[model samples]
Target: MFRNTKMRLGGVNILLLTIVISLIVLYRSTSYCLCKVSPVEEAFGQPMKSQPRPDSGEHRVTCHIPGLESRKQFYQYFTEKEYKCENLRWFGSRDGRKAVCMDMEFYLVPQDCHVLSFGINNEWSFDDKFGAMGCKVYSFDPTMGKADHQRSQNVQFFRLGISNIKGQRKVGMGSRFDFFEVDRYVNILERLGLTNTTIDYLKLDVELSELEFFQDVFRNTPHLLRNIKQIAVELHHGYHGKGLNKTEDITDDSSDMSPISTYQIFWQYFHELRCHGFKLFHARRNGRWTEAVWGNI
Candidate 1:
């Protein structure tokens, strides 16, 4: 009887060991499968799909050509062509303030995404929506009355401005009389320890300063352009807008190019952006300016 009891105890121990080993193997396989799934897929339990390109039978306009001089030509070139983004979606305001391509590779792993939003004049809808989408957003606006603080769980607000050059420079907040100190885009990135990080989305609404900022990026730091995935900028043309009247001419850094009007510079900037592999995906008219979104092709 003693021998039988001892044998039974040994059998129970062996069964428990086998069960533990099998459970460990099952857990490891389950973890491996989970790791293979992307965050978007995990959230939906399926691959994120996009709509097929609409067969509108419309001939798409060719971009990056020179000699877009006239206002009519510029308007036609920008308005006629819309790049086919399969998963294009509007975020933020109900009026379609911001457009983001959801099918991009960056959206697959949204937790690792980062956005740099410039020129938020108290409109937090864009930043807030992006933050809620699991992207870490860094919003900068020197004109906003609030100081640098955490705007939300994932949004960080800074009292900085995008410029061509580094260091503090006075920029018009609302009018010619109201001015605030601002910093350069590269300088701000360095300050925020994001010089090497890939920017998933870059939102620029710096009034007329975008022209100078684009010149600086294309001329000096063209390499930085490679690290950016998407760009949404509000392009201001002519002298009718508030920023055109308040902000100074952006000639401080454009010594290489010949003298040109803001109209010519605007087209030139679009050309340069096209040369750098960015294609216009969306464009919307907002009063006197146009809000254009470009995706890296």
Candidate 2:
């Protein structure tokens, strides 16, 4: 009777050990499945989601500008803040002309999307890429020397340029001879019958004219911005040279302002945009220019 009981106890221990090994194997397999990479992530080269570290503070940090003399503080404001976007896709040239965060949550669907590309100086790669995604792209470049026509199935090139003023104005690159005509944002929308339509994306690479264009839009026609979902603009500063002829009537104190003051103005504009519910998602610096993308949340 004692030997039989010993054999039965040994069999029970063996069963328990088998069950433990099976559970360990099952847990490891489940973990592997959970951590598997998705095809979309693999194609886009996006990093796999990992467990957050305890020391890593993945929270948004606010930048406070105390005075205009804080040039270090101004640049720090641009670099310190973090605006998280899950899916960001690049569209345009491999060089600096491309846009970031085009595939953000608000801009998931590319179909029937309207893209206004300002400052396409013969670089159609960005416009063409978005156009191929079923977006109707309107490319503007007064300096391209190309007449207004359909460049592709969905892309349209225009000799028109963006300006604060609605009427014809002479624009040049520090030269008296070379000049072009440009119109206001509101006027262009009215002409294109898009006054009531929502603009999916508005890209501005209009050299140094972006400051004036932004001032006009935010001050004169604040309502126009309500229709725009996303804005990607290359903000130009510290360039006081004569690029585009300034309107003699419109007072632009930017030229008079010191570099620190100019930075303050840019920060103020960005702050105003934030107040209007626009969040800056991505920013890349190329030389002295900073390409910033703000999405209306």
Candidate 3:
């Protein structure tokens, strides 16, 4: 009877051992399956998938182009300048709405302050605020249709575009739509009886065309820029804008202007501004572009 009991006990132990082994194997299999069905991997491919490198072949091609070093130098100089909040305080929406320097010494006028705002992409927060402060704002944008004129009672909206030259020319960059019927800045200002008048603030965001526009204004209308107390500009300085490679030929024969490097154009424009006694007090970076505020101090 004792022998039979011991044999049964041994058999029971063996059965328990077999069940433990089976459970271990089953648990491992289930874990493996769960890993294979990971939500992150299923949604956006494998986590270890290769990504595009920051330095690509195109970067290598354009990396050592001429004027790049000068641009870097200028950029270093630009970033190193010290700015005090008291003299140049930030105004408007912090999220790029109308964020610009107040320049207490320059922008704050007593009364009858005039502002010449160029480039209207349906953004008028800056205009509206200044107009509320009793400033006569003249906003120009040739792209606007007739129905959208006089967007605000205080701001006088004109269906005209500003350019270095007068008349219509197809203006576009990359694969974007081109603009037509753009007018010259000098002619428009003269026609509006704005000559000899102090433009308290001159805001420009004319895309890549500002490169030429600045050059033209500096050459033809020096007094216009001088009379302006403050100049706030969004400088677009990428390959798509005025910063194309010098070797690339411009197919537009009507433009009369020769192709120039980004560094050359910017250097000339900034140098001219500095020569005209405009101080670069505030500069904010927005992706590939910069919002530069120059005040007459």
Candidate 4:
């Protein structure tokens, strides 16, 4: 009986060892393994749902800003935080009595972001709460599968898209958040005379391939950042080891998006956000990590 028990223990050890080795292999081999692809449309040019995503991804962590260790603290995955907020128009507390924090430089969003959906996953939840006191909320997902309209109560949705660039490759992605490049979004806002409006909250959940679109915005549209008191940006790293097909091979087009991994693009952008005076106060790794930060300056 003792021999048999020892044999069982040995088997369990071996199983654990195998599992650890597999995880290490996958992590090193894959660029951003946590991120996934849409089976329906690899580029997801159609509306899958209508939930406004404050930033991106499903997993997140939240803590009372100016938190006290006397209480307790820990991390939870695949869970959500109640976007408790008063209308942005009201002169009230920002986060909760305290703010949700990140680990970076420490920039907390001044307003609540109730995301309805992002990219192809459009039917999630901003379903819980709607707006903040003294704040106006809007969603710019091209994945809405429409032109212009109101999606939810106090929620204005727009479908104008950037695709890739001004004259780069275009998609049938009329409104389904199927495009890349973010400069066009800025251009649209500029034209609307809303460029100067303070965006207490904003989210960018576009796939990793278009991460450069954000870098371009911070570089060229620094003024736009002034309006955004806080941002829930989702910076995807790699394409989960999935190699992208070259445009030249697929369509022989010279003005196609130069294929690059999401990691290369997003890492550069993260550095850019840092230089802009925002700091990270919270971050959690789910399929992807969703973090909350606030501005120090």
lDDT per residue (tens digit) for residues 1-297 in model 4:
999999999999999999999999988888544546433224335432333333223321122232212101112211333232222221113221112223232233335432222232353233113343213445555545666566555556565444334433333311322343233545556554565554544445544424445654554344445455545544443233334422233232222223353433444454455565555443434364344433433
Put the candidates in TM-score order, highest first.
1, 2, 3, 4
Candidate 1 whole-model C-alpha lDDT, 0 to 1: 0.72
Query: Which sections of candidate 1 miss by over 4 Å?
Result: 1-65, 80-82, 94-96, 105-108, 240-259
Task: For candidate 4, report its TM-score.
Answer: 0.47
lDDT of residue 191 for candidate 4: 50
lDDT of each: 0.72, 0.71, 0.64, 0.42
- How many residue pairs of model 2 clash at the backbone? 0
Off by over 4 Å in 2: 1-67, 94-96, 102-104, 170-177, 243-261
Which candidate ranks first by TM-score, i.e. highest? 1
lDDT of model 4 at position 22: 96
lDDT of 2 by residue, 1-297 (tens): 999999999999999999999999999878866665544345436533343322222322244434544445556656754467677777877443665564445664668788899988677788888899998888898887789999989998889888887556665434532557888887788778788778988998877667768776665556567678888888774454464334322244433245334455677778767766688888888777788888888
Query: Which runs in model 3 stand beyond 4 Å of their true positions?
Result: 1-68, 82-96, 99-104, 146-148, 241-243, 246-259
**Residue-level lDDT tens digits of model 1 in 149-250:** 997899999888887765566565335424566666656777777777889899988877787688766654565676788899887665433543434343
Residue 194's lDDT in candidate 3: 77
For model 3, which pairs clash?
none
How many clashes would you count in candidate 4? 51
TM-score of each: 0.69, 0.68, 0.66, 0.47
Provide the RMSD of all predictions against the true structure, rounded to 1 decimal. 14.5, 17.1, 24.3, 23.2
The stretch of ten residues in a row with the least summed lDDT in candidate 1 is 51-60
